[model samples]
Target: MNDECDFCRIVAGEKSAHVLYEDERTVAVLDQHPAVTGHSLVVPRSHEEEVLTIDEATTTAVFETLRCVADALETALDPDGFSVFHTSGPLVGTVEHAHVHLVPRFADDDVTLSLSRDRLDPDDAAELTARVRDAL
Candidate 1:
């Protein structure tokens, strides 16, 4: 874990967080600045800057914890829906440590989390699919 990272500090118990769950591999905590009341973040104990660079075991642990936490949020909050997401890279997100956001959504909330609604042309879609499939 990087000493300079805030999440690393929280993981190390050098700093305090409203942690909801913890095991040998990962930790889940309430987001200090939540998008909704039950917003939480699941983070791996080992420092990983992004999901694409992490090992398979850590990735599994993180998402498994996310699922467990999501279930808990659902039972406790009984929201209309839920949103599980992550932000990677420096361009569009702030936190450097890899984490997943589990947001509980209510029916009447005036909030919308969406990406561009633009539809790609068929040829462009095919080209993108080919690039991704070939890379895999």
Candidate 2:
């Protein structure tokens, strides 16, 4: 664990977080600055800077924790739906630790998650897909 990282502190029992769940590999916590009520974060115990850098086992555990948190939010809050996703880099990854957000959504809430952008042309889409598959 990186001693300088906040999430590392949280995982190491050196910090305070409203922990929701914890297994050997992952921990779920309430977001200190929530976008909506019941918003939670699924974090890997190991301090990987990004989701893709974590091992498969940790990744699986993180996502499994996400699912579990979603279910709990649904059961506890009975929201209209959910907004579950992960973010990295400086733009949205303020925490620096790789984690997934499980947000309980209500129909009346103003929280917006939408993407509107120009669609790729068919040829461009096909080329990108081919390149991605080749890279994989």
Candidate 3:
């Protein structure tokens, strides 16, 4: 466990969090500062600063836990929809440990999670897609 990481401390039981589920690979917990009423966080037990650095097995476990958490939130909160996302980098990560956020969304919640409407040139889009596919 990473002593300097808050999430690692939570996983190690050194800090307190409203943990919903915990297994060998991941832990699902309630977000202390929720975006909506049912916001929760799914964190991998092994410390990693970002998704790109986490191994594939742990990533899969985290996502599976995310699905379970989302389903539970839907049943409990009855939100119109929900958002599942992860933040990376120093500017947006807030916490250094990699974690997925499951935020319940209502129709009138006034929260916006839309992509920019700006259109990219077709060639640029195709090139970008090809680059991503090649990288994969």
Candidate 4:
């Protein structure tokens, strides 16, 4: 963990958060600026700027924490469904540390989380797929 990251401070117990869950590998806490009620963030203990760049064990721990927090949100809030997501890159206002948002969604809520449905050219799709597979 690093000193500069706010999440690291929270993980280190130097800062206060509405902590939902914690273990050796990860921590889950309520989002102060929630999109909806019962919105939470699952963060890994180790400091990594990107989730994809983290080791497999830490990645696994993040997913496990996400599942646990989602289940807890279901039992407590009983939302219609969930919108589990996260933001990345400097263009968006994302925190430096890697985290996953587990947002509890209600059918009546106004918030809409969506992606553009632009059509992808077949050749572009195939090339992109090959590039990703080769990188893996």
TM-score of each: 0.94, 0.93, 0.91, 0.92
Residue-level lDDT of model 3, residues 37-66, one tens digit each, is 888999999988887779999999999999
Error of 4 at 103 (Å): 0.2
Task: Pick the winner on TM-score between candidates 2 and 4.
Answer: 2
Off by over 4 Å in 2: none
In TM-score terms, candidate 3 sits at: 0.91
**How well is each residue in 1-136 modelled by candidate 4, as lDDT tens digits?**
7898999999999999999999999999999899899989999998888887889999999999999889988999999999988778899755899999899999898778876898889999999999999999
Writing each residue's lDDT as its tens digit, candidate 2 over 55-114 gives 999998999888888888888999999998888789875678898888898989889888
Candidate 4: C-alpha RMSD to true structure equals 1.4
Better of 2 and 4 by lDDT: 4
What are the lDDT figures for the candidates, one per model?
0.90, 0.89, 0.89, 0.91
Candidate 3 Cα deviation (angstroms), residue 127: 2.2
Model 1, span 16-60: residue lDDT tens:
999999999999999999988989999999988897688999999
The per-prediction tally of clashing pairs is 0, 0, 0, 0
Off by over 4 Å in 1: none
Better of 1 and 3 by TM-score: 1
